[model samples]
Target: MQINKRHQVSPYLVFFIIYNSQVGVGILGFQRTIAAKAGYDAWIGVIIAGSFVQVFIWMMYKLLAKADGDIVDVHSKMLGNLLGSVPSFVIMIYYWLASVSVILSFIEIIQVWMFPTLPSWILCSLILGLVYYCVSGGFRVVVGVSFLSFIIPQLLFIVLYLYPLKSAHFSNLLPILNHSYKELFDAVKSSMYTIAGTETLLMFYPFIREVKSSKKFAHLGVLFTTILYTISAIISFTFYSESQLKETIWPELSLTKVIRLSY
Candidate 1:
């Protein structure tokens, strides 16, 4: 499983990968979770949580850069062979769980919105096949597909953003900081899950061709992703009532339904 150093990705591709990976499967449910915690001011909570995640991204980069090893090697170096291997195993297990959960979530979305009669296993198999193709192509191809994914969804968002804007209620974002400090902290902690993929840098550093610029590109990727996530959250909260948002399965797609093309 030796990674070739010849296929270094540019900062922009790194940005695309971070944004695409972070945005998937979670954006649909994030509004409900944030609304539950911060009420009408959920966008504020999202912004704050995203900012904190940016910090975590930095910390992860620092840890990886300092260790100068892949994630498994870093852990083994830090915690000794036995203890480190235990935690590394747990992390890898969690990664597999997270990946499967994401794939299943996407299948569920397709079942509800696009293919009502399609079996979940069929959708899952299709997604797995695509994922296998990309993954087997190596990191460069995976990053390229990530860039394509990022572009298509963002273009869709641009179209969706232009609609009647009837659902937007700016007042829902007011009265910020009403929650207790502990409550706010808890909300932010939960929100961290949406911003978790930048930690991929740990596994990816060894594969990155430009090792010297890895931290720079990683930080840039995180910053760009955080901004996009915050903006998406703001748009979601602005357009939907707390109850409406909570009830909606995919708020962004729900928002898209309001768009009217001139045909």
Candidate 2:
């Protein structure tokens, strides 16, 4: 089914969409998990996991091009409607669970930091309502939100890095290849969950205005987030030692506490 031109977004917007999807609440604390086994060398695992995502993006484009529609269409083409809908339903459930996980994470952060007495269900309901409103406006509204999300926090993060940099022990990252292959691979596996949102393309492929030209933008978005995660991991590694990082739950968020700005 062809999407209306009005509902379609520009190819370049794919960068922001992909970036926003991948960089969720996970980034705040992924450092601890990735570094658990691989030690400081886990930043390398981030790059490795990103390379896998790049390849996955390439294959998705090829398949979607052939199907000429979203994942549901691909399913219908390959399998009969009845049979295909089964797996499609499962995929939809998976996305729902993923979204819920992210939402719960956001609610947890809010409750822990800003509203200690706030009930989880209230925050969850409010967030779901807001999401429903935006989604009802169609994909374009979501794309606009994605773009702003990519731009605004970026500036704040740039400033946030300065505070942590002053205390970072660069020596923490020395002996880059000291970890064994097993440890490195363990890090890669853990990092995969943090960088796993690119599969969202399967649902929105048909919503892209220039589907063919959009591949580069999609991959560029992945590359950008990959670099972002890599840099984030490296910074967290250098800022906190092996034992300290293990104890600190949200390393990135904790980095913000040290930021000081005079009026």
Most TM-score-accurate candidate? 2
lDDT of each: 0.74, 0.94
Clashing pairs in 1: none
Candidate 1 CA-lDDT value: 0.74
Number of clashing residue pairs, candidate 1: 0
Q: Name the 10 consecutive residues with the lowest summed lDDT in model 2.
A: 156-165
List, residue by residue over 1-263, the lDDT tens digit for candidate 2. 69999999999999999999899999999999999979999999999999999999999999999999999999999997989998899999999999989998999899987999999999999999999999999999999999999999899889978789999899999988999999999999999999999999999999999898899999999999999999999999999999999999899999988888899
Question: How close is every model to the real structure, measured as TM-score?
Answer: 0.90, 0.98
Write one digit per residue (lDDT tens) for candidate 1, span 137-174.
Answer: 98889888887887788777666765626667777777
- Looking at candidate 1, what is the lDDT of residue 81? 87
